[model samples]
Target: MLISVQALRALAAWVVVCHHFMQIFFDFHATGPIGQFFTDKGAVGVDIFFVISGLVIYLSTQNKDMPAGRFMVNRIIRIVPAYWLYTAAMGLLILVAQPLMPHAAIDWTHFILSLLFIPSENPGGYGMYPTLNVGWTLNYEMLFYLLFSLVFLFEQRHRPLIVAAALFAVSEVLTRLGVISHFYRNDIVYEFLLGIAIGVFHRRGWIANGLWLPLLAIVGGLLTIYHLAPSDRLLHWGLPSAVIVLACVSLEPYFQGNRLLKVLGDCSYSVYLLHVLVLYGGWLAATRYGLNPYAVFAVCVPLIALGGWCSYQWIEKGLYLRLKDWLDKRRNDGELKALSRQEY
Candidate 1:
C-alpha cells in the first residue's frame, strides 16, 4: 500500500515536471502533438496529487493522536524549510541573473507571500503565481492543511466523514456564492474528497485486491480524459485523477514497488519544488550551446532528478529530522516539568 502511494507520488511529481518543461520550453499551444499531450497529462498530475494528499492525510491520521495544532505544525515543518530555501535560491538567482529569466523579477511582496504560502499575482505577468512559480500549488496545499487540521477535533472514525462532508459543504457553498478563489474554490478541492473516499475504502478493505481491475480503471479514466477538452478541469481532469488515485490505492497490496520510482517518490516534494529551477537553468545552458529541444530534455530530467534527490537528503530529510528531534525533546522536557510541578 505504501509502495503504491509512493510510486504515485513519484509519478505525479515527474508528470508535472514534464508538463512544465514542455510549457516553459515551448509556446502555450504547442505546435506538436507530444507537447500538447504532455501539457494535458501534466494538469492531471496535480489533480492526482490533491487526491493522494487527502488519502494520505486520512490514512495517516486515522486512529492517531494528532492534535490540530500539532498537525499544522508538522505540516509546516515538513513543507516550509525546503520551500523557503528554494524560494530564497530563486530570489538570489533573479537578483544576479535577471537577464536569464526575463519574466521573473524580485517583487518583494510576491516573494514574501510565496514564503508564507499565500497566493498572489506574479510580477512575471503570470497569473496568481508565487515567486517560485511551482509554489502556487503549495499555497493550495497550505490551505488544505489548514482546513484538514480542523478535523482533528473529531474522533478518529468520524474524522474522515467530517473531511468529506465539510469539504463538500465548503465546495458547494463556494460554488453557490460564486467565490472567486482560483486557488481553492469549486471542484478542484473535491479531488481531495475523492482521495478521502479512496482512503476510507482502503481502510475498510472495501476495495477488491487485484492488478487488472485497478489498471483497467486507470487506463479507461485516462483515455476518457484524453478525448475531453481541458475546460471544466475538475470534471475533465479531476474525476479521472480521482479514478486513477482510487485505482492506485486499490492495487497497493498487490503491486511490487519499483525502487527508483519509490526513491523519486521519497523525494517527490523536492522534485516538484526544484524541477523548475533545473528546467530554467537547463534552458539557458541549452540555448547557450545551441542544443536542441531533445538535448535539453535529456539533460534537464537527469539534473532535476539528481538535484531533487540531493535536496531531499540534505534539506528535506536532514533538516526535518533535526527540527523534529528538537521539537520532540522540547515537548518531552515541558511535559516532565509540568509533571514535576504537579508532584510538588
Candidate 2:
C-alpha cells in the first residue's frame, strides 16, 4: 500500500491558514519575537505546498505509461474543476460582500488573468489583482503544469529530466542576471524538478535505509529554514520537503492506522482550496463579534476541516474519480480500436 501524502497536504494548508490568521490579526510590524517570527515565516506553508505538489505528481506518474495527452488531461481534471468552482464561488462572494466590505472591488482584467492562470503584472499585488491572495499559488501551479505537459509532449522519457533541469537552470540564471523580475523568476520550477528527482530515486531504490532517511530529512528541514530567503523560503525548502515526503511514504504503512490523520489527509485538497475562505470568513465573524484570534482559530479550524471533508466527499472525490475513470476508459477503448483496425 502506498503512503497517503494527504497528511502533508493537510498540514501545509493549516500552516498557511495559521500564517494568514497571524497576518490578519496580529501586528506583524510590532516589536517582539513572536511578531518577527510570524512576519518572517508566513510564506513557509506555500513552499511546503509546492514541494508536496511536486512529490505527489511525480509519484502519480511513476512507472506509469502516461502519454502526453493523457497526462495533461489527468492533471487538468484533478486541478481545474475544483479550482474553477472555488474561483467562481469566491468571485461571487466578493461581489455580494462588496457592499459591506467597500474595499473588495473586482478588477475585470485581473479576474480574466486569474481565469487563465496567468500571473498579473499588477505591482505590489499577490496575483494580477487582489481579490483572492491564495489564487497566486494556483497560477504558479498552472504554469508548471503547462510547462510539464509541453516537455512531456516533445521529449522522450530519457530526455525529460535533462530538459526540466535545463529549464530550471535557465530560469535561475535569468533571475540572477536581473533579466527576469524576481516575481516572475521565483524558483518553483526547481522545486518541481527536485520532486521529479525524488520520484526517480524511489524508482531506482536509491533512498537509504530508515534511520538515515529521516536524519537527512531533518537536516534538509534545517537547511530550508536557514537558507530560505523571505521570498524564496518555500522554494529553498524543496529538498527538505522531498526528504519529508520520502519519510512519510516510507513510514505511512507502519503507522498501521491513524484514522484521524488519514481522514484529514483524505480531505486535504478540499482543506487547501477552501481554507482561505474559512480564514477570511472567520476573521470577519470574529471582528464583528469581538473574539480573540486564537479563539477564532479554535472555532474556525474544526469548521473548516468539516467543510473540507464535506467538499472532498461531495465534490472533489466524486468529480476527480469519475473524470479519471472516464478518461481511462476512453484511452483503453481507443487503444482497442487501433489494434482492431491494424488486425483487419
Candidate 3:
C-alpha cells in the first residue's frame, strides 16, 4: 500500500471529526463564513474515503488473482470486528447515558441492520443513517467490496475493465429507472468507479509525470468544490475528490510518510469510529465550564486524536491480531487433517 494513502486516510478522518466538533460546539445552522466552510464541507472527507477505497482495493488486487472467498475474508477481518465492537459499546453508552446525552430513540430493527452493515433508514427519522450514524459510510464500503469482488471471478488482467463496465452499466440503469434515491442504489457508488479508473490509469503507467499538471488539477478541483452549493450531488464532491486523489498518487514519487502520519493512518479506522464519542464527551465537559469555543476546540481535537491512538493500540489492533490468529489456527488444523487423511 502507498504510504501517502495512509496519511490521507488519517487526514480524512480528522476532517470529519473537526466537522462534527463544529456542530457540537456552536449553533450548527448559524456558522459564520469560515466556520460554515468547515461544517458544510468537512463531510467531503467521506467522498475522499470512497475514492480511496476504490483506488486501494483495485490496486491491492489488480495484478493478483484472488479468490472471491479470500477477498471477502480479508475485507471482513479488516472491517467487521472493530465496527461491531464499537457499535455495541456505543449502544450501551446511549442506554446508560440517555438522560445526559441526546440520542435517537432506539429502533431494534435499525440497530440490527446497523450491526450487519445493512442500509436502512434511521429509526428516529434522521434519514439514512445507522445506529452509529457515521457507519452509513461502512454500508457503502461493504457494498463496494461486494461489487468489486465480482471482478475476481474474471481474468486478472481484465478485472479492472470488467468491474468498471459492470459499475457503469449498473449505475446508469439504476439512475435511469429513478431507483437511485434508494439507499442501496445511490449514484454515490459511481465515485468508486472514478477511483477504479484512477487505479487503472496508475497501473497502466498512464498518469502524467509533470508536477505542474497535478498541482493544477488539485487547485482547480478545490475551487470547484468551494463553489458547490451544499445540496450538490456526487459529481460535486466526487469529482474534486477524484482530482485530489489523482494528483496525490501521481505525485507519490515526491512524497514521504513520516512517523506521525503513519501512526494516524494506521489508526485512521479507529479514529473515525471513536472520535464522535470523544468529541461529545469533551463537549459535555467544556459546556459546563463555559469555556471559549476556540479553547474548547483546541483542547478537544488533540484529545480526540489521543483517544483514537489509544483505542487503536488497545482495541483495534489487539482484536485484529486475535482474530487473525484464530483464523490461521483453523486453517492449520484443516491442513493437518487433510495431510493425515492422505497419509492413511
Candidate 4:
C-alpha cells in the first residue's frame, strides 16, 4: 500500500469527524472559521475515501484470479463485523435514549435496510441517512464491491467496461424513478468509477512517475477544498480525490510509511465508524456541564481520535483476527474432507 494513501485515509477520516462535530454539535453559521472551513469542505473527505476504495480494491487483485465467493467473503469480513457491531449498538442507544435524542427516531424498516446496506428512502423521512448516519456510504461501498467482483467472473480486460456500464445504468434508473432522494442516486457512484479509472491508468503505466506528482496532488486537493460547497459533492470533491489518488500512486515509489500515520490508516475504518458515538457522548457531557459549543468541539476532536484508536484495538482488530482464523480453519477442514474422500 502507498504510504501517502494511508496518510490520506487518516486525514480524510479526521476531516469527516471534525466536519460532523462542527455541524452537529456547533452551529455551522455561528462557530467562526473552524466551522466555516470544515462545514464547507469536510465532505470532500468522503470523496477521498471513495477514490481510495477504488484504488485499493482494484490494485489488490492485480495478477490474481480470486474466486468471487472468496473475494466477497474477504470484503464482508473486513466491513460487516465492525459495522454491524456499531449499528446494533447505535440502535440500542436510540432505543434507550429516544426522548433525549429526539432528532434520531428509529424506524424498524430503516433499521433493517441499514443493516442490509440497502439504499432506500429513509422511512423516517430525515434524508437518506440510516439509523447510523455514516452507513449511507457503506451502501455505496457494498455496491461497488458487487460491481467490481465481475473481474472474477469475466476476463479482466472486459471488467472496466462492464463495471462502469453497470454503475451508470443503476444510477440512471434510480435517479429516474424519483422514489428515493437524490442522495441515493448513482451520481456519487461515479466517484468509484473515477478511482477505477485511476487504477486502470496506473496499471497501464500511463500516469507519469515524477517529482511533479506530489506538487499536483497538493495544489489540486487545495483547490478542490477551496471551491467545495454543500452541493455537487461528486464533481467538486471526486475530481480532486482522483487527482490526489493519482499523485499518491505516481509518487508511491518515493514515499515511505510513517509509523504513526500508518497506524492511523490501519485504524481509519474504526475512526470513521466510531467517531459519531464519541461526538454524541461528548455533546451530552458538554450540555450537562453548560460548556460552550466551541470548547466542546475542541475537546471532542481529540476525544474522537482516542475513541477510534480504542475501538480499532478492542473491536475491529479482535473481530477481524477471530473471523480470519475461523475461515482458515474452515478451509482446511474442507480440504481435508476432499482428500479423505479421494483416499477412500
Candidate 5:
C-alpha cells in the first residue's frame, strides 16, 4: 500500500470526524474559523473517501485476475463485520435510551435493511440513512463493488474502469429521467468513476512527476471543493476529490515508512465507524455537566481514535483473520476430498 494513500485515508477519516464535530460546535454557537471551515469543507471527506475507494479498487486488481466471488467476499469481510457491530450498537443505543438519542430511531424492518445495505428510509426521519448513518456510504460502496465485479465476468477486452464509467453515466441519466427508479439519481457516484479514471491514467504513466502539477492539483482541488458555490457535488467535490487523489498518489514517495500515519490509516475504518457514537455519548455527558462543547469536541476526537484503535486491534483484525482462515481451511478440505475421490 502506498503510505501516502494510507496517510490520506487517515486524514480523510479525521476530516470526517471534524465535520461531524462541527455539528456539535454549531448547536452550542461556537462559530469560529475552524468550525466554519469544517462546516464548509469537512463533508468533502466523503468525496475524498469515494475517490480513494475507486482508486484502491482499481489498483487491487491491476494486471491481475481475481475471482469475483473472492473479491466480494473480501469486501464483505473487510466491511460487514465492523459495520454490523456499529449498526447494532446504534440501534441498541436508540432502544435503551430513546430520550438521549433524539437523532436516532429503531425499526425492525429498517434495521434488517441496514444490515443488508439496502437504502431504506431512516426511522429517525433522516432521509435514506441507515441506523448507522455512515453505512449509507457503504451502500454506495457495495454498489460500486457489485458493478466492478461484473468486469470479471466479461472478457478482458472490456476495461473495468471504462465499464464503471459507462455504467455510472447511463445510470445517472436513467435515474435522473425517472426511467430507472431502482437506481438513485446521485451526482456523487461520479466521484468513484473519477477515481477509476485516475487509477487508469496513473497506471498508464499519464500523470507526470512534475512538481508543479501535484502542487497545483492539490491546491486547486481544495479551492474548488471549499470555495466553489452554486456547483453540483460532482463538479465541486467529486472533481476536486479526483484531482486531490491524483496529487496524493503522485507524492507517494515522501510518505513511505511513516509508521504512525500508516497505523492511523489501518484504524481509519474503525474510527470512521465508531466516531459518531463517541461524539454522541460524549456530547450527551458533557451537556449534563455543563461542559463546554468545544472542549468536549476536542476530547472526543482522541477518545474516538483510541476506541477505534482498540476495535481495529481486537474485533476487526481478529474477525477478519478467523473468518479468512476458516474459509481457507474449508476450501483446502474440499480440494483434498476431491483429490481422494479422484484416486478412489
Candidate 6:
C-alpha cells in the first residue's frame, strides 16, 4: 500500500515554518552569508508543497472510481473549510493590527480577490497583500485544483501528464514574453505531471529496482540546493524535489507502519496552518521580554510544533473527519434516492 501523502505535506509545512521563523527573528539586513542564504532558501518550501500537492492529488484520483463531480466536491470539502476559516481569522487580525503597522493602503479589490483564491493581476507588488504574505501559494494551489478537476471532468487521466507539460511550456513562454510575470506564472502543472508520471511508473513496477532512484534523488537535492536563482528557485528546485519524494515514497518499506512519522503527518496540516501565528506570537513575547532571536527559536520551535500537533488532534482532524463524513453521507443519500426513483 502507498504511504499516506499527509506525512510529506506535514514535512513541507514544518520546512515552511522554519523558513518563516528565520525571517521573523533573524536580522537578515545585518547578518552574514549564512543568514542571507537561509532567508533566500526558505521560499523553496512552497515549491516542495506544490510538487507534493500535485503528486498526492493525482494519486488520489488515479485509482478512484468516483465521478468527476464527486472528486471535485471532495477536494473542495477538504480544503475550503479550513482555508476560509484561516482567511477570515487573518482578515480580522489584519484589521486589528493595521492601526499599529501603518503600512500600505488596503486594496479592497485585491483583498477580495485573494479571499476568492484568485491570483491578483495587479502589478507593483512582490509579496502578497500586506496582511497575508503566506497566502500567495494558496492562489496557485486553488488554480491547480480547478484545472485538475476540469481534466478529471473530461475523463482524461491518461493524458493529464501531457497536458500538464504543455501548460508548463506555455507558462514559461508567457513568462519570457512578459505576458505573464515570473511571480505569477509557475510550473505547478509540470511538477504535478511529474508526480503523476511517478505514480504511473510505480504502478507498472519500473520503480521496483531501486538502482537509479538514489542517484536521481541526490542530483535533485543538489539542484535544489544550488542551481536555481532565488527568484526562479521554485521551478528549478521543484522538479528535483518531486523526483526525490516520488523515489522515497516508492521505497514504501521506510514509511510503512512508521508510527512516529505517521503521527507527524497527521498533525502536519495544523502545523502548517498555525505555525505562523505561533511564530508571530513568539516574536511579540520575545521582544517584550528582550530575548535574542536564536534564543526565541530555541524556545518557540518545539512549542509551536507541539501546539500544532494538539490543534491537529483537537481541531483540524476532528473538523475534517466530521465534515467529510457529513458531506459523503449527504451525497450517498441523494444518490440512493435518485436510484430509487429510477427503479420506480
- Candidate 1 lDDT by residue in tens digits, 1-344: 37788898888898888898887677456777878888766767788888888888878887778778888988888899999988998888788778867888877888898898876688878688887888877776787788889887877777767776766765667646756354556567777877888888888889877888999999989898899876787788888888888888778776565777578688998989988888877777776788787688898888888889999999888988899899989999999999999999
TM-scores of the models, in the order given: 0.93, 0.81, 0.90, 0.91, 0.92, 0.82
Off by over 4 Å in 2: 1-4, 27-38, 99-103, 121-130, 151-166, 169-183, 212-216, 219-228, 231-236, 247-253, 256-259, 327-344
For model 5, state the Cα shift of residue 4 in Å: 0.9
| Ranked candidates, highest lDDT first | 5, 1, 4, 3, 2, 6
- CA lDDT of 303 in candidate 4? 76
Clashes of each: 0, 2, 0, 0, 0, 0
CA lDDT of 165 in candidate 2?
60
Highest-TM-score candidate: 1
For model 4, how does the per-residue alpha-carbon lDDT over 228-341 read when each residue is reduced to its tens digit? 663776777778788887887777666675678778888899889878877787777777788886677778777777877887877778777888899989999999999999
Which 10 residues in a row give candidate 3 its minimum summed lDDT?
178-187
- Clash pairs, candidate 5, are none
Instruction: Write model 6 residue lDDT over 1-344, tens digit each, in one string.
Output: 25545566666787788778777666345366656656766666676677677667766676556565766676666666666666566566556655543432346686677667766643225554323557777766665666666565455445565447546755677668877446546544466666666766766777764546765775667566665665545456766677666766655665678787778877766666667666766776687788887787788779877987777765667776887899879988998999999999
lDDT of each: 0.81, 0.67, 0.79, 0.80, 0.82, 0.65
lDDT of 4 at 260: 81
Per-candidate alpha-carbon RMSD to the true structure: 2.2, 3.9, 2.7, 2.5, 2.3, 3.8
Residue ranges of candidate 3 with Cα displaced over 4 Å: 100-103, 165-181, 230-232
Indicate the residue-level lDDT of 121 in model 6.
47
lDDT of candidate 5 at residue 66, scale 0 to 100: 70
User: Which residue pairs clash within candidate 6?
Assistant: none
Model 3: clashing residue pairs? none
lDDT winner, 1 or 3: 1
